[model samples]
Target: MELNGVVSAWLLSTVKVKKIKMSKQWGQKAEELEISNKVAGLGLGQKGSNQTSDTEDGPDAANPAEASLLMKIIRQGLVESKLDIEIQRKDPNSPLYSVKTFEALHLKPNLLKGVYAMGFNAPSKIQETALPTLLADPPQNMIAQSQSGTGKTAAFVLAMLSRVDATKNYPQVLCLSPTYELAIQTGEVAAKMAKFCSEIKLKFAVRGEEVPKGTKITDQILIGTPGKMLDWGVKFGMFDLSKIKVFVLDEADVMIDRQGHQEQCIRIHKCLPSTCQMMFFSATYHSAVMEFAEIIVPNPIIIRLLREEESLDNIKQYYVKCKSPEDKYRAICNIYGVITIGQAIIFCHTRKTASWLSEKMSKDGHSVAVLSGELTVDQRIAVLDRFRAGLEKVLITTNVLSRGIDVEQVTLVVNFDMPMDLNKKADCETYLHRIGRTGRFGKAGIAINLIDSPQAMEICLDIEAHFGKKIQLLDIEDAEEIEKIGA
Candidate 1:
């Protein structure tokens, strides 16, 4: 039988064991059996008396390293199984909840084909809970929060495709993001998801995209930034709001927190049909954002997957204490030699700092790219494309690339200046989003907060208190110790 069947049988076999003694014995037997099965599955057969010996003989009796590896796998499997059970038990009324297969959700044939073509075999926890609520009759509004790279994009993209009336070419669905890069990324994903539905047209209203004046948007789905989207709707009169069936606000918290984004978003919302279904998604939401959401999306079903403290557990966070600004630079350069980083992002607080760092790094013989608001839209796109394609190894930027830019190979993030607001206080939200650029999809990552002064250290402490995570100290002098930090 397969691993799933084995897990199911193991779960079922212990259901009727009521007594504590019986339950303990069953648990032990189940663990041993599961471990044995996993060992066989890996083609690591129990070969000699030493390998096949009893558990009480301890891992030293066999290979100590192999025993440690097996224990780690077992613990990880138990954690995943527990999470799956908890998710299923939490939302029993959801039709898509606990569904193992996409076909079980009864999605449209085209959507199903798109999903499989995208290589998704099973529904993620967010998809299992949010899809049914999104696809329900009357199309209720929804507010979902999940960690970065948890299939939230796919969930909402599926919803948008499912709700669109492909027969109508007048912008039936609209999705808004905070940045041009993010907007373009979302549009690309939506296009891929709706590939089988060839009749479904998609439009992007991001910066630098030339939408001819007086041209009507005949696409079935529209994705863009709030400013550009509103510009197209109000200035160019490009969108037909009455025909819009679904509206999505990606990165809701960031969108609402910006200077004019809230007002622009409200204007767009006001123009949409009252019957249009609204969906909001983000990695984090403040109480104020939640209050605003209550007003924008009426009677919404909220699916929050992570609390503040529970988030970003997959990313190992640390801080390097430096004696001066020069020491900080030396520490950063030293890090490149110590860690095996696939890609690194260094976050500066200002464009000037980013430019200076970029120049300095390039002078030091590193392939680096600098991104900030100073660059034109086309320039930003080119830099991002090269970085995403792995042509650039280091990206130095301000807050522009902080949120919603998903680069899978970014294994290291350095908070060079430390994210701080105008009052010189720690900006927890930006800090979270900055580190989130790495650690995509539950992959292990490392974030280094370089601190040169007591104030910066205090700011790091505030961030630690905010997220309830410890920022371990790193000894820059000890190369071996730094190497083992993320390993």
Candidate 2:
């Protein structure tokens, strides 16, 4: 669903990632999704080797496009774009124009080719709604509230690449991610899309990267963290800020919270010429972040998610009543796969717990991976890469990794410890993003919270009350009840 890094389901039919050996269970899940997606009119995309498809088929489809289907999965929380046709819209025509497929965008031939090869058969609901307004000439600024699997990364990457002038041989676009890991993830998606744009050079301005002094920085696209961008663009005179055409802040909520990052981001924004287009994206927008965003991106076309979509109703919420901290280990193993399933993610409150869980799970002969703030940027990327390759069945980490990690096979998310904010209050937003890692696209997913104390139970209850969604008590001892998760 995040297809953020995971390939789209229909396109997965033709994508052959060499090292990843998906199990029969994985194949079955993919097959079901491929079938269901086709029925929804999202057929397969192009495989690199094959250049032609019949008028109605993917280049490598072995079966007919009219194959029988499985149960339909609803893709919810579509984005709605209107600058003000609430009588004051940016373009009276924008709300009326939506593309069913990327082809309708009429992207450059090579750019479109990369899109198809990446397995994006059709634009996600958000993409179809937002791209039209984003790609229009004399670019319009935007502030978007979107969740994982809604195609926010791909949407912005498409916009950045579309506006780049490859022939200029200079940086035309700049994207700011909250952390080093997120910048790399967003870069991975952009690199795949710009594969065919031979002359477009994309650069990462993250930490530890070195550029020679006096060497002209001519990359057409830039993605990095705010501190590094400020250090390189301001402390040093490496970047030519005046020529930037488009500027973006991915995960603006976190950026606003990071100490000094808000000021650094603003500094970078001030250097850009007024004509530069600004875009701010985040899953949840707190009032502070909203205020910060408006200050940097003026008169933006704001996109809001419907209440139903924001509710995370697609993920079933359950809480286990555990007697002690030791019992959480048992609870995790018990409901991991009530039925044959894909990968899973487990969240803990601290790195000490994450390390302990990792050692325990590994000693018990389970294939698990651990990620925390302690990991270096490269270490975190490698951990996510292994998880995506299906080398690890479970990823145990803390809030540090919660906001990003968009693996498609993830079907289960466990709160090894309930999440809480700095003031010890239930963190409804963090809980949503944690479980949001699963249920990508439109697939059903399950989230289990292990409450080991009255405090934890109270925290769980607060979250339930905040979202107006019930968190049912789960009986781990009941087999039949557990098995119904996949149902």
Q: lDDT of candidate 1 vs native? A: 0.71
Worst 10 residues of 1 by lDDT: 1-10
Q: After superposition, how far is residue 475 of candidate 1 from its true place, in Å?
A: 5.8
Query: In model 2, which runs have C-alpha deviations exceeding 4 angstroms?
Result: 1-96, 113-121, 147-151, 165-171, 179-240, 307-323, 326-346, 354-397, 400-414, 434-449, 472-487
lDDT of each: 0.71, 0.71
**lDDT for each residue of candidate 2 in 241-356, tens digit (9 for 90 to 100):** 89999999987765655555665776687678899999888766655556666766777887766543353767998999999767888877676536666888988876677778
Q: Where is model 1 more than 4 Å wrong at Cα?
A: 1-98, 114-122, 146-154, 164-245, 257-261, 264-275, 308-323, 333-345, 358-373, 376-395, 403-413, 433-448, 468-487
Candidate 1 displacement at residue 251 in angstroms: 4.1
Please give each candidate's TM-score.
0.61, 0.63
Candidate number of the best TM-score? 2
